[model samples]
Target: MKLIFSIRSYDWIDYAAGLILSESDIYHVMILLKDDDGSMCDCKNFCSQAIYEQRKFDLFNVGKKLGVKKLINLGYDADEIDINKLTSQLQLYLMLSGVNEVYCQYSLPILEILKNICNKLNIKLYFYNIEDRKDEYLMVVGKEIRLSNDIINIKNNLSNLTIGRYTIVVNNETKERFYYIYKE
Candidate 1:
């Protein structure tokens, strides 16, 4: 299965558009790494709280738009960058879930790290960039190509789908807990 693993940001409309327009059977599994610098000052600010809430709300809407099957968050922060922990977690998930293709949105060292991980795990990796958002139908990283249809605005087409929301239940076959779309 294909997995859309995003981090740090909730900009998923472009990814959703690529999948929809291509008619590819790709399941989005957003892995939100909580690397927020939880400073006391930042936490205490009212603006910060409001922005957090807004971000959460936006994430929900984006997930719904993408029909995300699972949203995983690795809680807490580390004092230092623990490559082993990060690699193991990602590898375990990919192995367990049988994910072959990983479309990721991350920056810097993490991007390089993901590349190495995907390479080692024998999985296809696509660097998902919001800047190259709707221009390319398929997420071919580094390729600059305009989408044939200028009239088609992808963001406008994102309508929330109506389906029975399922809680994270253990899959009998895989023995893995899956959280489908959240219920309102």
Candidate 2:
């Protein structure tokens, strides 16, 4: 899946995927050692966290270890977010990718704009409020999507991925209701 995870911060890193793989915490990390003059800053692998850490990296194949094929990070200080810029950039980025689905947090007020952009691109964007579990809908999208089986399938897949820790959401309005598993 071509995915973009809106990361809160790098305090919790998913080193296994070299990017923010989850909205939760993980034990993985990546060290992009660079010269004092910033010569190795490739901007490809270096994501929002990498930039915050003063490092750079290739973000395209970041999720190979986590089952996500094309994952990108849109890191930000939620308290000081520029929603307009974020939305515009997000639309551009999605337009340039091969992504079929999107997982975004309803907490982001720009979700409406993001939804419109996704609609234009014919992409499936699933917005969820994971912070709360009593919502009527697991997702919020266009009317057309709300009436399709695509959303239902996404809900099921997300529930399975999260190990049944999610609710199906009757969606009086309406979301990953996803995480990776590993066996040692």
Candidate 3:
């Protein structure tokens, strides 16, 4: 499957890497950034400039290991484009490229935007939020899709994994959910 990742920082690195590594059917993975400098979001990152640079480098290195196929910058500064234009561009890109899934992290506004676009395109969108888990064990809840066998393998292989009860949520709700846990 083809996937698009809207990235902002290294916060989602472990989840992203885990998903990519576990899902062997991935054929093309595109890294989408909001700016040319590789720092994708307009939000303030907590680290120093030097540390930020290193994080970007480390992120790319991890992507290389995960076999990411393309890196694309949308080329929109904070003041350069409006939401309608951004939405249009994203819609056109995903429609043209036939992207099957979209993975996004860090920014809730961006996630909403992508969620709308993906819903329109009938593509599955997964939001990776590291802070949402209950404890040491990662939790996943999905509306449409189920946890794959690969995830089960990860759960079984890890000795340090904390057992936590998680239920797969399916309802008439419009939102979707997916969570991945892996040791770095």
Measured over all alpha carbons after superposition, the RMSD of each candidate to the real structure, in angstroms, is 12.8, 13.9, 10.8
For 21-61, candidate 2 gives per-residue lDDT tens digits of 33333322211112112112222343434344432232212
lDDT digits (tens) for residues 10-116 of candidate 1: 33444434453444465755555543332222233435345444445555665665556665655424455577788788778887888888877746666787788
Please identify model 3 stretches exceeding 4 Å from their true place: 27-56, 75-81, 130-134, 143-184
lDDT of each: 0.52, 0.39, 0.51
Better of 1 and 3 by lDDT: 1
Regions more than 4 Å wrong, model 2: 7-64, 134-184
Residue 110 miss distance in model 2 (angstroms): 3.2
Query: Could you tell me the lDDT of residue 132 within candidate 2?
Result: 42
How many residue pairs clash per model?
0, 16, 0
Per-residue error at 12 for model 1, in Å?
3.7
Q: 124, model 1: CA deviation in Å? A: 1.0
lDDT per residue, candidate 3, 1-184, as tens digits? 6564555433344445555666665534444443223221222343344444444464465556656665554545545557787778778888998788776664656778888888888998766553655554432224222335665455333322211111233584332222344332
TM-score of 1: 0.58
TM-score for each of the candidates: 0.58, 0.42, 0.56
Shift of residue 62 alpha carbon in model 1, Å = 2.2
